[model samples]
Target chain A: MTTTGSLANGEADGTAGSAAPDKRGHRVTISDLARQLQISKASVSYALNGRAGVSDETRQRVLDLAEELGFHPNSAAVALSASRTRTIGIVIARDPTLISTEAFYMRTLVGIEQYLNEVDSSLLLRLTGENGEDLDVLRRWSRQGRVDGFVLFDEHQNDPRIPLLKELGVPCVVVSSNAPDDGVGRLISQPEETVTLLLDHLAELGHRDIAHVSGPFHFIHEQLRVQLLREHAAARGITVRHIEGNYRYDDGADHTRRLLTGPDRPTAVVLGNDLMAVAALRVTAELGIDVPGEVSILAWDDSPLCELAGPGITAVDQQTMERGRAAADLLLRLAGGQQQLHLEAPPGLLRIRTSSGPVI
Target chain B: MTTTGSLANGEADGTAGSAAPDKRGHRVTISDLARQLQISKASVSYALNGRAGVSDETRQRVLDLAEELGFHPNSAAVALSASRTRTIGIVIARDPTLISTEAFYMRTLVGIEQYLNEVDSSLLLRLTGENGEDLDVLRRWSRQGRVDGFVLFDEHQNDPRIPLLKELGVPCVVVSSNAPDDGVGRLISQPEETVTLLLDHLAELGHRDIAHVSGPFHFIHEQLRVQLLREHAAARGITVRHIEGNYRYDDGADHTRRLLTGPDRPTAVVLGNDLMAVAALRVTAELGIDVPGEVSILAWDDSPLCELAGPGITAVDQQTMERGRAAADLLLRLAGGQQQLHLEAPPGLLRIRTSSGPVI
Candidate 1:
């Protein structure tokens, strides 16, 4: 076996050796070189596998020569010794267009990429359409060692992905806590506490009627936040009503149009996501409802969209970037075999933006 | 060298060496089972390599064994044998957050995933910060055989990534036409043409003195589109001026304040992104600017952001998903040795929403 540094100059080097050892960064394996050189397969195999039948002179010359010329084993053998495949698999539940609109997901993904860059790992993505035939595709690629681990996005309340992911034996981390399995590691935003704090902020504004517009009911984090808002509002002798919608701006607009223009209108509204909140701001404007004078809106998931909204939506900042980084760190630890399975990182900041003013 | 059928069910019939093996998945290699069992490595090697030193009965038994048990070789062996990875590496300029928020990028990625899934190949993403570090990471990973080929995202004018990627000796599909090397597989969206079409739509509506709020100045697509808009307006005898800003909603608001309140303001405006168009709507609402009468706005990158924008933004639908799928197909073909490298897909409709109308 010849252990050598990768060639500084990009050059094809072919030598017969049982295996080629490469420098960590620039590996060009013997098999790759063999293919490049068009050498006999058996000769290259004998040379690399270190079978004793090969002449000593030829073997020594091959090893020494490969070292001098920078021949290394291919990525497959390298993968066996090192767990990293230099790729990360990500699973998203919604359309690509939806993911692009959510600033939180965008920024958090940026954070994950920052860490991945530090380690020289790549990110692989899969967006599952309805019925999740895509999941099966993921399963096959993962089994074939196409990626190192997975970054699971937009978890549902009772995710069907969990059991299958577990059975497959790939390392993964979830963005939301809706379907947090005890066996799997998680990075959860403090959804309940975030909602409580938002309620307190609204309650302090002297709002008597507060209504919540939450994301899809299937999403556990939305359920938890909405439930908390209801319970907390009741404790303060305030009545709260919740309407279900996807975590989308249009949904927010639709819900707001229904809620704001009707009798028994709430003085304040809370949204499950920032997109929805921005929509609510637009709806309120269209209906000529004075914000904070007649009604106030508080949004969840403090993405940049909240900051850009006209009234500057008052939002619950989950610090998605911090959460994404933590998830990456935990997954790295697991991949390295340095940590026990199943870790839980805490929620981050609850930055309140400007949308919700003192309710008149 | 015993090949006795060690089926989990313990049937142990002599059908172990049958060429027609169990169809559940791949047959597990003897080496994997031997490693699992912690038996002597030499013994397992002897049985698997088909060396003639062992007894005939034991050899047949060993041959009969693992097949009935249904254990398959790891993907590494298959990859080496077939010389095909069935996986493509994508080097993303930004991280996951960008994937979720930037409609163009997210839609493209999703489209890429859609095609790859159909072919049973997977995408491998390597995220690099805006800094130049991503090139080195991609180069190293490509050399190591981590991916069959690559898809380059966010190609900038005078982009350094192009040169570095070229040196890696793998086929690549770029989301840009201004690539350093035009011969490589390219997937470029016709943004410049889209801009001209937007202008035609506006000019036909009797709008003059149009203003533009563009994305970052250096991005090749943004730069080209801006230039196209300026040229098209001059050709059409319509007055034009532009303010540079990011493709962000807040940037829209900021530029709107500058353009609307300032002297010599254009009656119509075109935004580089849908988010900015949405922001412009909010700004108009705040300043009491009437749409289509006093001021009108158009946006680029038709997405849900446009539809959700109160007065839906009139935008050039870039067929982002189709772009992504085309890129995926190109990379797969190159990796599969078909070698049809360069491609430019057609642009789709410019969906007219509530925002765009004739100037009074």
Candidate 2:
């Protein structure tokens, strides 16, 4: 009973009634186990680790001894014996500052952490220069048995990490923006539906000439949105022009200024994200243009910031939290060696607000 | 030369001329080495790892063989022998979503990552619920020898993590806004001087009554900023009011709406951070107020969003990137068992922009 209680404490660490680890960084080495159980070091190691050395009764006794000592086996030590580290790796493919602005990544991370916590698995976060240079670290982790598996995000078409993940032969889940049936497990979100909803909403308001300021063309999600917008705009016979931005606040303001100064200024504008949408409002104010009355605006992502902005912008709710949870679930299943093929988050909702109205 | 070159590749993985890690996760084990070099596994292990059983000639031969084979000693294996994992831990204490909007944390992470990369170490990032619940992971990593040191941020006075670090006997650096002087390898930023400069700037512009929308009282930086604001306001014989916020956009909007509805609204307002300040502009616009004419506004922590906001907010540039780098440098020095410390970033500069002007 004390052994079970202590083992539970070791598993559910950081709570009351949990067995505190030895303050001296003392590990339950094979020798330590052998000394305690009055057995040979090799015998204890093989028995506890389920190797071919000792009897079933000896293995049970060794395991019981381990539990009594409150030793939660080191994942790395267990790796050599084909055991779980109870950890997941996530590589953020950008600078922390840029990544932080998109609540989607953070919310998704929270979801992953929540599910991993339930399984008593911790997360190992790594940063990359958007160039997949950290792929080697992931490889080393696999070889050295550092992490049991990984969850990847922000992959481009023909991603280098995809082949690497397969080559490493590790259980992994890739979070994607588009439908990537990449053989490996993945979670995808619908970008086309968001664009369609925006076009419909903007069309209902009698907007013919519209401008969409989008992020860089390389990002899969950005490209998908742009493609969808062009298709819908052509089908509906709406005159649509596009401007490109680097997904920054300044980019939004600069591109909007360029859009307005053009020979034919559009009656409505759709910016890439919340930061750009907010920047668009600043541009409209500087140019003495009345929002909705002169030019309506729709943001890509709806956050509290959108609502907090003056005359809250009409935007699509990406349901980032749910998307994040789905990705985590996919990884959890994959890490368990189960094949969960693909998942898609529900289509984004069009949040109509004060920023969009009938074009005058 | 070829042997040395191959060894360097194993050591400097991801760089040019480095041999790729085995796709199938092949760790060159002692057995593998013994079989290849025609020696006993025990002799190979002892000679390669500097354990007592092997002669000096055998050790050199083992080392040469290892280099020739491009063998990289696993970090986890080395860790068991009281070696570093070459990883540093950083625990973020906030909602990942809310934390993303503030550029401060990310800038600091970049700083930490940059330094860690230079030392051929990697970063291990973890998310916390702001309650230090993630301390278990930190403790486990220490006992398991997963990381060599830590870079801590948002530390409260007498932070619980400080005592925990001392108990773990791990090298760490605590980054604080105020002069910590906590003897825990702290890097301080100039909060008081920034507050003073702000007051002086506003006072010079003939602003008598000013309001500071401070963050929650629990945060040490917020407390220091509020104290210094009160001190300077009192010294200058100016009427100053303080409002509290959780430092979110909604908090900015809700608090500003409250400030405006109140009978005594200050002529100018200072927000805890850039987001709150940006939200204040939206609230002002909703109330049909003209910035720098009816009300002057100042935001703490300048990001590009500050410049992109309507009329632009006069903000204190926190030099966040440099601040972050300093914190990282401090942690690195500590990790190397060096006593070099007592780092402080240059004082924040109050960048005067369109948002602040002569009081109407």
After superposing candidate 2 on the true structure, give the runs of residues whose Cα lies further than 4 Å from its correct spot: A1-83, A95-97, A100-104, A117-119, A130-132, A230-235, A239-245, A249-255, A285-288, B1-83, B117-120, B130-132, B253-264, B286-290
Q: Native-vs-model 1 lDDT?
A: 0.63
Candidate 1 lDDT, A65-154, residue by residue in tens: 556656543322222225556566776657555665677666666666655554345567665554355466557657877666777766
Model 2 chain B poorest ten-residue lDDT run:
B1-10
DockQ top scorer: 1
lDDT tens digits, residue span A44-113, model 2 = 6567556675898888988887777765443312432453666678766675556645555655666665
Which TM-score values does chain B get in all models? 0.73, 0.75
Worst 10 residues of 2 chain A by lDDT: A1-10
| Displacement of the residue A308 alpha carbon in candidate 1, Å | 3.0
What are the lDDT figures for the candidates, one per model? 0.63, 0.68
